[model samples]
Target: MTAPTTSRAARAALVLALLVTGLSMRTAVTSVGAVLDDLQDDLHASGGAAGLITTMPVLCFAAFGAATPRLARALGPHRLLVVALAVTTVGLATRPFAGGVALFVVVSTAALAGSAVSNVLMPSLVKLHFPDRIGTMTALYTTALAVGVTAAAGLTVPIGEAGDGWRQGLAAWAVVSAVAVVPWLPTVAADRRARATTLAGPVAPTGPDAAGSAAPPARAVPMSALLRSRTAWALTVFFGTQSMQAYITFGWFARFLTDHGIESGTAGAMLAVLTALSIPVSLVVPRIPARHHRAVVGLFVVCLATAYVLMAAAPRPTAWIWVVLAGVGGGSFPLLLTLLGMRARTADTIATLSAFVQAIGYLIAGTGPLLFGALYGVTGSWALPIAVLFTALGVMTVASRRSTTPRFVDDELAASPR
Candidate 1:
């Protein structure tokens, strides 16, 4: 089915909303990594507490993202996103003022909570508004996401150094989140009008019955039924493992470089390079035909595994090389995001599948940084953390074998006897 007829202004507003929302999502998480040491020093946080800070994003995302479908159904996606962005702005602006480690985590969780909702809703919004243009829209927003990740990683240290400290750098993102809320506000009104139009219009179901009359409305697949599908499970594993690697990269890659005797600013720059590469890769990867996804996934796994080995073994001497490899591997993120749209037919199904994938995927991702920090605290090195990434890559490889196949959740549900 085509998107509901929208005024040009409404379309423009939606595009801006998607771009800025993508830009705002990662700043809360990545900004901290560049100034982590100073923040830890100020808070007098232990290594375990520091690990928890990095882990908080995924934890909050898992918790809040699971509820987004329900929230969107009741409030509408655009209106809910306006609330999410406002919460994000408030959380980002205030968290920097928290006095101790615990308060900081609490406030940061609030910020991540907002990001979590935005993250899950983006795919559903794209599917709803641009059903035939999924690849293009996914690339546009994911590229914007990469830009945000790169800017936050590369500039945070310098921003911190220029101001009072890490607080200034971290809080600066609140302004961007505030700006993102504007586009969404207009879209909320547009959404109401669109819904009214949909309700008032005649229902022309897509297919007919054997007697040649119009068919009934397609039923949305429930989340519980997804648990029984191998494809859903595989996609979940694929998304989880890739996110684990990504969170590790954002949370610790800068610190890893600094620990290896690289300057902090240079380390942040390397991390920036890693994220910046994803912009182009995100654009290109989503456009690649699904037939090539397995080969692409294999290539990404190789680059990621090799980067981990190099970083663990000889981080300083060839750090840039590792960053390049890892950045290329990070393309898997956009790949999986594209699949969220591809694997489902209707927007409702996309929302359900997207939530199912991200909610659980992030739970699995949350463990990466926590375990990375725990092992580094215990072993006094990065080797074990890198080893854990290697193990995740293996799991991702196995999972992608089924996930990358061309299939739809709607079809799977129709075939199920239950």
Candidate 2:
């Protein structure tokens, strides 16, 4: 069947919705990392609990990602996006009012669940709506995500200094999601109408196939199908390891610096630079020739390795350099996200792969912060924790070698049962 056609205006509006959604969702999650100390102090949270605060969104992302494909199938992707956005809005708006850690967890979990679905759906949306501009649009959306992260991480302290409660600082991001919905209203209506028509079709009794034998029942693509594909497993490992590194940095890098004798504000600024630098790096790296992409991947790994070495060896004057290296390596994130679209054979395959990869991938990824923190608690120094990061990067290097190859689509197709 030919894909459904949407007008240019509608497409533009949908893209806008995606960009704004990306920005809002990222801001909500990253802002707390920027002000972790303040939030911990204000709420009287322990280090372990503060760690959970950061990990909560990632856990929700993994949990909710599994449900997105089924939800999209039932509600239609467009309408599901509307509901997700609304949930995100409510989640963000309520953060300031939560009475304690339990309430904070509830609100934050809901918001991140919404954001998680949105993240998984975004690639398919790009494929459906802007097939011709996947690379460009991926770059844009990823850039918006980077900018949002940087803004939230960088500005939270300043905003709090300006007498806005950190709660208010964090809650303010909901307005972005609310604004993003404006451009989506018409598309949501159209999707609801289309779904209504689909449901109203003449009913045929469910029975055997045309051959007169019982029709082979449609089963979910087996989870093992993904496990058996070397490429899929490689991508999963790549995503999981890199994501672990990213979240480790997001959740603990500021505190790590502060512990190393940097002031909290300086640490936050360094984190902002690390995130902001990813915008240009993400945009530029994808445009390079595919044959040479592995070299870029190697460069990122080297940068990460060097940054970890410096962070462990020289903690003060060289901290900024380490942050820059981390930022450059962070570009791999958007690269992986873009590849999810580029590497899939069909929209159905992309949806399936997206759900599987993000769900399993993030569950693995979500452990980094807790593990690193626990290691610190035991070792009583950052050195061993930094060593663990280096090990993860080494694993990422091996996984990325396969991932950077321009053949996952072909590999997945060849591996699929005929």
Candidate 3:
């Protein structure tokens, strides 16, 4: 079915809401990491215990995101996202008061679940609301997400100074999430109307005959078909590998720099630069036409390889060079997100494929740091893990090429003889 055209103002409003929603999603997790050292000192937690705090977002993302589509199907995306924002707000605000690690983890898990739902749903939201402007909207929200993370990391410590310490600093993001929910009130109203219409009668269920008359758009491709597609598996693996690299870099890059004799403050600044660099690249890459994906991804991979080589050979003096190259390599994060929409024809497919990719992908990703960290512990050198990252990037480049090929997920599934 043809999508109803939204007025420019309404479209702009939706984009604003999406930007706020995207901002709300990542800050809760990153802010926690910004203050992790303080939390560890306060709780007297072991390195493993402290690491879990940073890592919990990935676990919650995979677990909760695996189930988000089911929830979105039942509640509808806008209403569900509103509920997610509410949960995120409550979780962030309340976790600071938890006096111990166990309670903190529980509350943080709850918060991250909310963020996970938002993360998985954003692409589908973009698909549904801004089909014609997928690249633009994706870039806008991605840019906001990048800025949100940078701001939280840069400012949280100063914010925390007004209160007891890191706990209060961490809790400050509750304001961001809380404020984000405001723009969604209009969206929730619209979702209620749509849900009402959907429930009012037989809902004009779609069929093979949908194109001729009053059948709903051909029943959304079953998730089962998506599961059978070679394209789907390739994209999912691509997403997983990129996420593994992303999570590892976010969680451990600073420590690696410090270990190499950089001061902690300078290391943190370098890591921030790596993250900040992704913002412009994220905005620009998605806006490029599909034909160029291979060249773009190829260049970024080459840059990443160069960075890895530098780190292995002359990590200290050339650290800036490595940081810049590594940031571009990580551009795959947004590029993959853009493909989720660019790839799927129907909003249902976008939503389901997103849930499937991220759910499975993050579970795979969540293991990267632990596995590599364990390898480091056993071998006592950075070479082994760096080599492992090289292997992941090699495989990721292959999968990314397959995912970027100009084919729609729905088209692939429909062409199946089965």
Candidate 4:
């Protein structure tokens, strides 16, 4: 039997749900970075501990990404998202009330995990629900995510100054998550009804040429197969290295600027600009076809390289030019995510690739901030660390070129016929 088709109304509802979900998940991670200094002073925390607050959310992305497929398999994607949102609410609510370092860590980690699962599952949702509009919707959702991160990062300082304390400032983002749930609830309900009516009996087994096949055998495309693919490795490495660079800027660029004699507020505003400027690029780039992927990737690398050189060598006025260049270069993120969706042969394949790529990739990426910090601590200068970033970007250039080709999923499917 054919599966039930979604109505236009259902499709619209899914789009809205995804937008809000993306916004809320980003706010959870970005808000704390904006108010880090206030939180540190208020809680009497050390620099390393404050850094952990920022790092925790990213680490959670890798840690919890591995579980998203299992959760989706058991609960269905819509229901799993609701659970993730609920967990996010609990995590945000408890953060303000945490009495000590231990409690803060626990609550923060919980929040991060929720955000992580949402991040991993969202691309698949986009692929499943809006395959025709993948380019457009991917652009929109990614732009929303960039906007959310920028707003939270820019507003956290002002919000903390407005009232209660840093705790309240950090906790305020729960409201966004709560509002996101309104549209999602109906989607979840509809999904449950759909599942109950459709899957009333055991699934049929497929020998060959079975259109009803639920999924392929695990052995068909083992982890070893993915590991052996150069394209897959290049994609993974490209994603990992760019992510590391992004986090390094996100987590420490403000501090780096402040240490170099810029005022704290100015540094923070610049950081906000860096994140905010990417929104337009992210919204526009994914709508274009794969033919221009290599050119775009090469342009991003050049922008990043130019940004690093100016940042290290130039004086004040020209420095911000490089900053803007760096922001525009970071547009590669949405491009990569869109490529991931377009590269997968099936939903199950997307899930497996996402888990493997993100889990190992993010863990490798997670070391950037710590390594940058350690390098600075030892050398007592930004020059060497900036060089390190340039080197990473160089590697990113080559890896991105390999990933820009559009033939991986096709090759895999052709190799392993049904």
Best by lDDT: 1
lDDT of 2 by residue, 325-379 (tens): 9999987888777777666544445555677788888988887877898899998
Clashing pairs in 3: none
Per-residue lDDT of 326-412 in model 3, one digit per residue for the tens? Answer: 988888888888888777665666777888898888888888888878888999889998987898899899998889886666666
Clashing pairs in 1: none
Whole-model lDDT values for every prediction: 0.81, 0.74, 0.80, 0.74
**Residue ranges of candidate 4 with Cα displaced over 4 Å:** 1-4, 189-225, 410-418
TM-score of each: 0.87, 0.86, 0.92, 0.88
Model 4 residue 200 CA deviation in Å:
17
How do the residues 1-418 of candidate 4 rate in per-residue lDDT, one tens digit apiece?
A: 1123678887787778878887887887878766666677767788778767777866788889877776666676677788888889889877867876668889988888888887777766666666556678888788888888888877766776797877777888888887777777876764576553211122222211123324333212333456656667777888889998998888778787777678887886787789889889988998877778889998888899988888788735565787789899998889988777666544444555666677777887888888888899999989878987987898888898778776544255446535
Worst 10 residues of 2 by lDDT: 201-210
**lDDT score for residue 142 of model 1:** 92
Off by over 4 Å in 3: 1-5, 196-216
- Candidate 2 lDDT: 0.74
